[model samples]
Target chain A: MRVRAQMSMLFHLDKCIGCHTCSVACKNLWTDRRGAEYMWWNNVETRPGTGYPTGWEDQDHYEGGWKPDGDGITLRLQGKGKALARLFFNPALPQLEDYYEPFTHRYEDLFDAPAGDVQPTAVPISMVTGEPMNVDGGPNWDDDLGGSDIFARNDVALDGVDQTIRAQMEEIERVVFNYLPRICNHCLNPACVAACPSGAIYKRGEDGVVLVDENQCRAWRMCVAACPYKKVYYNWSTGKSEKCILCFPRMETGQAPACAHSCVGRIRYMGVLLYDADRIPEAAAVSDAELVDAQLDMILDPNDPVVIAAAHEAGIGDDWLDAARRSPLWKFVKEWGLALPLHPEFRTLAMMFYIPPLSPLVASVERELYRLELPPERQDFELFDRLDKARLPIRYLANLFSVGDEQVIERVLRRMLAVRVYKRRQSVEGVVDDATKDLLASVDMTPEEAEAIYALTTLPTVDERFVLPPYHREMSIETLNDPLAHKGEVGVGYLEPPRRGW
Target chain B: MSDTVAMIVFVAFPYAALTLAIVVTVLRWKLAPFTVSSISSQLLESRKLFWGSIPFHWGIVLILLGHLATLFFPATVAWWNGVPIRLYALEITGLALALWAAAGLLVLLYRRLTTARIRAVTTPMDLVVLIVLAVQIASGIWMAVGYRFGSFWSVGVVVPYVWSLLKLSPRPELLQPFPFILQLHVVSFFVLVAIFPFTRLVHLITLPLPYLARPWQRVVRMRHIEPVG
Candidate 1:
């Protein structure tokens, strides 16, 4: 096995409140430059909405990500010959209009206004040209389903659901939505790396953080189109493409990423996963029905004696291995099988897993105000097997996470309900009920395993959730140069002029 | 006085252009690698670019190959032109491509002048390169029409003259019989080469030819790139 370590993340989406704190934190750190005003390296999206770049999931139009081509896979974007020919003008590239033209208010007018009867209003100006412009759209225009008619109705994933459920989804009384905060997936089979003509983008062998080497980028802009998530953004000022770096500089110093660290709802968890690098291709080449299981299979068990020895030989230190064993991502994604990747059909093998949000149960309203939800003390023992009766169709969640595998979504939801039942029975009744035990067994989970899931999900501290391995930056720095040697010298000096290369 | 002027234009100027092109291109690439680019204006106004760039590139590529053939393989091209039909075919094809290129360049120039976004990004150097290119094209078109069948005769005179330059033996007398337009074409060609590194034309040498043979996926490890699988 060609073992490699990957630092991954899991979002307990149920806990997310759609506050957009993580997005602001990431923007303040990385993409606050002049050209990057429109880029949100981390942005919270409302599910059932058409996302930031409208209809980005319509890969047929944008031509992003990979497709199953007979045995292996091929880029959905054209091959090499066509790519080189189109280098002069990439027809597939999203226009500045596809992503909204970033703007700022001319707030100076508010204070500079002469004494008048009316209060002065700030006029929005285009950030690109510094000219006055009408504000047409923004990064999160569809947040909280504000424009559900235009954006939510056009959601590409809705095509997978039955017509009846799809119709029911739009009804005001039956509407359902959730928050989906996104950053670069740092995919194992990254399409951005594959599409770059300059070979500027690469997946780091150290921790699998996909990075764009700014010095090597030739402004080809192919990566901007090829990423299925549309996470890569073109910087108009420097004439280069940029994306989320996962805050590698912070991570190397043993800290969580800005987005994860600043999550207000405590929904984000970060950790390392040891995976067999050799199996990446095989895992991605599987059929759509088997993709979720295939991806899960590639993540090697950290405590396995054989895997541990293989990782050791493959240059994984004991510290990283220990972190991998305690990885919350492992417990959430592999052990409990609760989280699944968003849209595995893209075949990028995206590493960011998400626990599908469990929405409120469908309401039975008679005459618009008859039903009342009882207090928590009332004895209730309803079966969670009625997945079909949830406010949101299971098919929609299936389409988002698995490739139309409703069974997978049902299993995860039932297990979560079972865990909650087991916890509540212990806390409120002060005794374990037989019904709760049967419910746990029905989901194929023992009480001890359920208790572990409950503890981690409900009451995990920051340190426990984010198990970071030491990057040993000091060792690498010393090998490259002596810090003390630079003390006698004035500033940095280049021994050789920089040249463009792979 | 005429001999001295011809020597400067034909002998001294060619060498100067060549030396400047090489030394300055290397320095520019070393000192500012980021400046080396096509500096494409397609993103600002793509419709005009598509209408202009494709035809211009194709026309220029074939015309360049024709020039190179006359320089290096004069005997072969001369032998092929022995038949009147073959000579006429080649001459007509060259004239059509020149016209096509000129039309595309006009469109491109109009777009750059008119488009607000493109004009914002335009530099004085960009304008100079365009004017230089226009001079070269206009001279060639003029020579092709005014001095008909010059290709059949240039093989005997220009080939030997170019060879003499490469051999370090200057020969300014051979181009004396040529018209002023023909001389203008030669001088303009050298001027284009002289400004190669300073302009967006640096992209000509930076073609991603390596991409054709290289693997799609890339993974880097420990400052050393792993062999693409």
Candidate 2:
């Protein structure tokens, strides 16, 4: 086993409140620059709606990610030979129109306009051309508008759901949506890295953080087409590709990424995970239905003596292994099986996992003549069967997380339901119901296990949420320059301003 | 006075261009590695570029290969030319490639001038390089058409002169008898080499050569981390 420790994340979607605080924090920290005005490194996308850059998930148009060939996978964008052929001009590249024309309100007009009968208004001007433009779209134009026919109905994720079910989802009263905050997955097998003609994008081996070497990027924009998640963005002004760096400078100093630290909902969990590096290809090569299990299998138990020996042999330090043991991501993803990688069918072996949100119980209809109120004893029994009747179809959640496998979604949701029911019983006296017991029994989860899951999910402290591994900066720096010389200068921004042109 | 002018054009000017090209290219590479790119505006407008770029690149590459073979492999060219059919085929192929490249360059120049998006990104150096390349190609085609058999004759006249320059020996007398088109082609070629490092032509040196054999995935580690002994 080629044990490698990768810093991973688990975003509990059930806890996300759809606040764009993470987006703003990441923007202020990283992308608030001349060329990167439109970039949102951490964006909170409201699911059941078209996401940022509008319909990014529609790979049929964008042609991002990997497609399974005969046995292995190939990039949906282009191969090595084809990449060179299209190096001069990438026809598949998304234009500035695909992403809205970045604009700013001309607030000067409000103050400087000549005296008039009506109050002067600020008009929007294009950031690119600096001309007055009609304000039409933004990064999150369809935020929380799940019932809208324009944006939400066009969500490509809903394509896998049955046509009838999709229509039902779009109904005004029946509309249900959850917030899906995204950052770069820093995937184990990043297609962006594979498709880069300049070999500019690469995953850091020490912590598995993917970074674009700005100096090396030739602005081919193939990374924009290759990333299944569309996390990479082209800086039109700089003529280079830019992406989420995972706030590695902050990470090195034992701090969570800007987005995760500033998250209002406390949905983000960061930690170390030790996995078999040799299994990455095998894990990603599995059939879509088995992808989740295959990826989970790659994550070795940190406490296992054999694994620990292999990890030490592979040059992973003791501190990282200790961090992996306390990792909430490990507990939520592998141990409890609550969190799952998004769109495993993309086969990038994405490191970020999401705990699918639990929707409200599905309501039932009864004829006036046959309708009867549920008795107190039967009420508890009816609650146990609510999983099959959830307002959000199992098929829909499965399509998003489990690669169209309903069984996986059902298991995670059941466990979450059991924990909620168990917590209620603990908090309120005489609230203990036979249905709650049956729900826990069906999931084969003990009361202690349910309470443990509840504690970690609902009441996790900041330290528990983010188990930061020790970054050996001294060792890393010693290879290039003297660590002592650069000891005082440890932060994100460049020491000198970046020059613009050749 | 004529001999001095010939020496300046044939020896001093060529040497100066070569020196400037080498020194500036190295300096630019060291100082501004990030900016050394073709800065392809393909993202802005690709349709015209698709029609122009492919034929232009292939035509120029084949033509350059033919020029290099004639310059460095004269014995092989002479033997091939001994066969009359092979000589005709070579001349025809070279002329076709030159015409193809000229056509492609014209289309590119039109795109650069007419397309607003491309025109916006076009720097003065970009225009100069394009014009110089066009002039050089036109002069070459003129030489091929007027002189009829430059592929064989270039070995006798241009190769010896080029060899003399490499050996740091002045041989302006040998090239002075050549036609104005041939001399203009030689001057323009050296001028192109001089401006190459300063322009988008720097991308020519930065081709991802290892990409042909590189693995699908790349894992970059901190340099300090080494395998446990």
DockQ each: 0.34, 0.40
Query: Which ranges of candidate 1 are over 4 A from the true structure?
Result: A111-120, A370-383, A486-502, B41-43, B149-151, B223-229
Predicted model 2 interface RMSD: 3.4
> If you assessed candidate 2 against the hidden native complex, which CAPRI class would it receive?
acceptable
Model 2: pairs clashing at backbone N, Cα or C within 3 Å: none
Leading candidate by DockQ: 2
Residue lDDT tens for model 2, A95-145:
666667678989999999999999999999877657788878888888889
A225 Cα displacement, candidate 1 (Å): 1.7
CA displacement after TM-score superposition, residue A237 of candidate 2 (Å) = 2.5
Model 2's TM-score against the true structure: 0.91
Query: Residues A202-267, candidate 1, lDDT per residue (tens digit)?
Result: 998889999998766777788988999999987766667789999999999999999999998999
Q: What C-alpha lDDT values do all the predictions have?
A: 0.84, 0.83
Cα deviation of A449, candidate 1, in Å? 2.1
Q: What are the chain A TM-scores of the candidates, in order?
A: 0.94, 0.94
